[model samples]
Target: MQVVKQLNPLIFLAPLAMLSLPLGAPNSITQSLALLLLAPIAFIATKSAIKKPIFITILIGTLLVSLFQVALNPNKEYSVYQAIRSALPFYLLCAIVVSYKKILARIIAFEDRTPGSVQKLFDRAVRVFATLSFIQTTTFFLGFSLANALSQSENDRVMIFQTTSIVLVFFYSIIRRNFINIFLTSIVIIGTGSKAIFVATLLLTFFAAYSRPKFSMLLKIVGGTLILGGTLFYFNPLVIERLAEFAINSDGEKFKDATREYEIEQAKETLLENPATTVLGAGFAMQVSHGVPSLDPAWEENSKYDIENGYWGALVKLGFFFTMLFALSIAKGLPRDEFLMAILLVQSVMFMKTSYQLFAYMDGVCMLLWSICMVAINKINANRNSHQSQFQQSIQR
Candidate 1:
């Protein structure tokens, strides 16, 4: 452990390199190894490590919630072991990789000695985040395009478009304060043809425009709305036809509406029927006869969807206690920045439509999002206090 700790910081980015490598690696194993490898770097970077109360509370609450579910699960097979199967992997990975103790203090201390030095630290942070976001978005697009050129698997194409769209939206939101980055991301997101990403991006644009009380902001909002709205209106068949059809006829739409409504209704019914299980959940995989269900089982995998999406899924699987803990953790720790808020909203919505509970799936993105918000908030508060103190001293003098 000590030897690993003593190694170079460059080693920390080794996993990131695999991300850019030709798609030869087993993506899951590579991501897991990368995070495990980077944990030490995170530990070293974490200085003055204090187990914050909120973090501790969240941890405890989640555990209690899981236990509660175990107790309430009416299914004879439901047990604590199954709960572990569902929630432990992602939560553990997040806990290990994500912390601010080492990185923020070092960067802020080094960046500025003056009253407003925190601003420099923030700018530096933004640059680092923006660069990584660009790289990830670009790599996903490259992979998608390559796959599309070689074969026409609808699954591959959809995955490519979805990945590109979500990352582009998040990246754009992160740098909403930067016009050039935002503009570039906007173009890429449009190219991706994902309704979720498009809607999320537009929400972000509207938020950025309204965050400041200036005519320029209003004009950008109006101009951006025109271009984005018009482009989708014109060229994107998916947007103009499918999305519009779904939007107007959500209750009667064929694919999306049917799927969404079926899942939602089933989940609600399940909760209602098993009131006792509502707190902790029916104990993961209650829908299945055993741990593994056959691919072409009579009861489709869609039964899982009936329980809820990500957040609700967490509640059902981990119990209400843990879900609330996770929610409180976010509320307490994340900053009030417009960009941060937008990303959080987007993530929350995404999780509703799809499962993002896999360890490798959520760890990197969630960690980065949490770190950015916490660090930015710390800088903002520190600067605000310093300014107030200086003003008071001047008055005294």
Candidate 2:
């Protein structure tokens, strides 16, 4: 028991460390292996806590849907397999959240001992990665062969870095609002060349700032935005150009719209062909190849055309009812805060252009945030109880 207590913090760090690693190389493998190792520990730690009925229902429902889909659409064997693989981590993370309150408390205790330690670590990591990315970008411009091996492309690196940073900012913002973290994270988001993420981050920033509605806080936000904007413009003028490009009707915008329309049309045709499949989803991996082709050949196999839109992806795999259940389950599980709600709303919009499965690495980061919130809430309640007890005792005396 003592040994387990000593190692508890390390378990939480495993996911963060895995997320920090380069994308598509060893990151996925390491995360899976770590989860496989940690699952038993998490279960042992929190098994005594009363299980939430809704989580159980959702878990069972998702599994049943996967199985039903597999049975009905045996041709989509690989799709079902991939979907299950993609979803397993999310379900596992939920189980960890439900059972690992003790571990969560331990992490919170560690944070209390060293205030801002997590945020500092996150900032340092982002800086290190960003520096490497900048060097690589510079070298590529200079026509250096070493640039290829130095770092991932700016677009890929920013996406990975920002995903990790957003998780940190989300949790840190909840604990203590800091403009520096938000500013740095915004820089990372802008580096992605993703207008949607930039807009989403902007909306989330305003939502978080307006939550307090203090004059000083509003001033800081405005001042920080100006500094951040100017710094980006001075250092990387292209970022400003990219942001400006979103407003204009360009060939890129036309191509993007055409692709989205084509994909939606194909989804409509596929659903119409087999109306019954619309209920539970043509059983995970029932491919509809009538639309846009995937650049990744793995997605092309088994008749699946990589659905970029998350909502459409969910609709394709889980169908209407299960999708609602899944969405509700996620909503129920998250910490109740307007900031978080705004973040989720923004993510939902961003998902229209990208695919983010529930079992993805970003979900792991979210699970950590949820655990931290739970610990904070518990502490607050405990303090309230203690204060009330003391008051009552004094009155009686």
Candidate 3:
């Protein structure tokens, strides 16, 4: 019984650890199957945790939207299997986060009793994972073809794992005020060559510093940002070039105006052709099958569907009403802390470019953030309660 109790935390950590596995470690199908299998265990473990009404509402809303889509678009080339494949990871991740709430409290209580142990464990794990990722990234940059040796899919998987590790370490360092960890993790994140992650990290660091607003914290933030910028500028100039290219393309230039005009025209035609789909979306499988048309010929050639924006993708998959409800649910579920709000804002921006909500790896990072925030809140409340108890005892004496 004691051993079983001890292992309960692992139920929550298993999916996260699985997510951190290198691309060569497991194929995508196997990794996905592993997460699916873990979902049931998570559900079973978290059965005792209190369920939030907002979460239930979101889950119900998702189901209703899916059902309505299926019912209304019977003639559309929709696949129930494909929809489940796309949606299950999200639902399972939700369950894991909800269930881990209780387990996290317990872990925190244990950490309070054993000072530095939890931090040490996390630091060791992060250092090991981040080191491996750094090595891989450096090898790739040195023209070793290590990353290219793997298939494109595998390479993407590896990068996702590395990115996830960097995010985890980054947040952990922020909470613990571990500068060394922060410096090392930032290097790995920049090495990934993802402009979005770079921007997200910077945003998170700024918000974290702003939350406290101490002079020292401000100095560290400035110093860290400069170091990151200088390192990237010297070693990986392409990141800056790509970001500049994106900014130029996104500006209200003639090309952008033309592209926007063409997209709007195509969208109007689609809505007119399928009026009902305008309300509840054309469903994922259908949307994928009949690709969303794009004004940019290059974009269309690159991707089957040119719905690069996550909000637009949500509208395509769930329609306006359901998308609104989903957004509301997320808003209601998030913590009120400014730091957390900043993280969510960063995540929201990334979601615009890609469907981060549906990806298990990104979801895991979110869950980690949620857990950290909840634990910090709990600690604060506990301290307050302790102070109250001491004051009451003094008054009685």
Candidate 4:
């Protein structure tokens, strides 16, 4: 309880969104919790972004267009609620979180004032989350179920938030060449069957280790690739359970996500459906449909959008101009740290798979944003400690 209390407001919404379990770490529950945290977040962000006019303008533009977008929607009642829930994650990042350079700077300053308080809280929270995630993964592998991992489909589980802290450890293990953590974290991540997360982690790990390019690093990469390739072609447990989806699913077909191409075509049609939708954007929960027979099994109804692709997702919702503007706005807030930058770089490629950056799943957005915050805390403290050590050594001399 005290550990949660010790969390700096900058990272508060993140943990709150991730740990929100009623919806089983899905977007709905996380967004609901994020909405609850918005008031305090907005208060903090107002103070934090006082000097950042771009952020203020972006917020204003979003609200104005969103109001217009909502009014234009035929299903106003549901759309109003849908729009609010979808955007809450974006609103709740009030470190305001997207302003990474400034927010991380504030966190560093807090560390200076309080010594090790925030870092300790962060580490402790991550340990708890990582353990829960590991247990869930283990349970899934052992032919059982826990919580809501298999609620949607046999092999499908969205544990992005739960796996996020562990991904940070996975990221750091590559940086430090810690084989034990690298192996353990790898299993938990891949077991979740998250293509975006696993691929992002693997790519970043490769880039970081490639900088050194030792024999061992190359050998690790080759060995790892071969193993993964083998599993994919051979006895992959992750998908083995998916066969059960057909037998148990009422639809009498295996539940599956729409292909990225299918989602893209549907989104394009919806975007160009009318001049108002084109110019102002479709307000909240706008459902796109096609004549295709198979449907997104996760949804109660088949309303698919190309939201898995962050850019395409935004384009459908906010039009070209606003979407591009939002993109630029995010660019302004990206971290300057090389390591953090590398993670974002990989995710950019995988945006076609999922959008953890903007209004994807609240849990994932919270998890990833929280993971970045944790990385910043650790990196800043380590650098400061190193400088302090050097200064003491100089004084002794």
Highest lDDT model number: 4
Error of 1 at 131 (Å): 8.0
All-Cα superposition RMSD per candidate: 6.4, 5.8, 5.4, 6.1
Q: What are the clashing pairs of model 1?
A: 45-102, 46-102, 69-280, 267-306
Q: How many clashing pairs in candidate 1?
A: 4
Measured by C-alpha RMSD in angstroms, how accurate is candidate 3?
5.4
Candidates, ranked, TM-score:
3, 4, 2, 1
The TM-score obtained by model 3 is: 0.74
Which regions of candidate 4 deviate over 4 angstroms? 1-27, 30-43, 70-78, 93-98, 116-119, 148-152, 155-168, 177-184, 211-258, 273-280, 285-306, 355-357, 372-375, 378-382, 385-397
Worst 10 residues of 2 by lDDT: 145-154
- What tens digits encode model 2's per-residue C-alpha lDDT throughout 66-137? 677667766643465656655665566555545444554665565566554544554454345444434433
Q: TM-score winner among the candidates? A: 3
lDDT of 1 by residue, 1-397 (tens): 8544323322333343233333433434434454465565545533322266655554565566445554555654443433444444545433432344344444444334344544544444444444443454345445643311111223222232124223433444443456655554454454455566566666666665666557876786678678767875664445456557767674674545555555555555555556555654444535422222335452244344223355555555545655565566556544455545665656565665544433214343433433443454457566778999999999999
Which candidate, 2 or 4, would have the higher TM-score against the true structure?
Answer: 4
Task: State the weakest 10-residue window (summed lDDT) of model 4.
Answer: 298-307
| Candidate 4 residue 104 C-alpha distance from true site, Å | 1.2
* Candidate 1 positional error at 355, Å: 3.5
Alpha-carbon lDDT of model 4: 0.57
lDDT of 4 by residue, 83-178 (tens): 655565555543354555655666676676677766666655544555556665656656554533422346544353445545656666565566
TM-scores, all candidates, are 0.65, 0.70, 0.74, 0.74
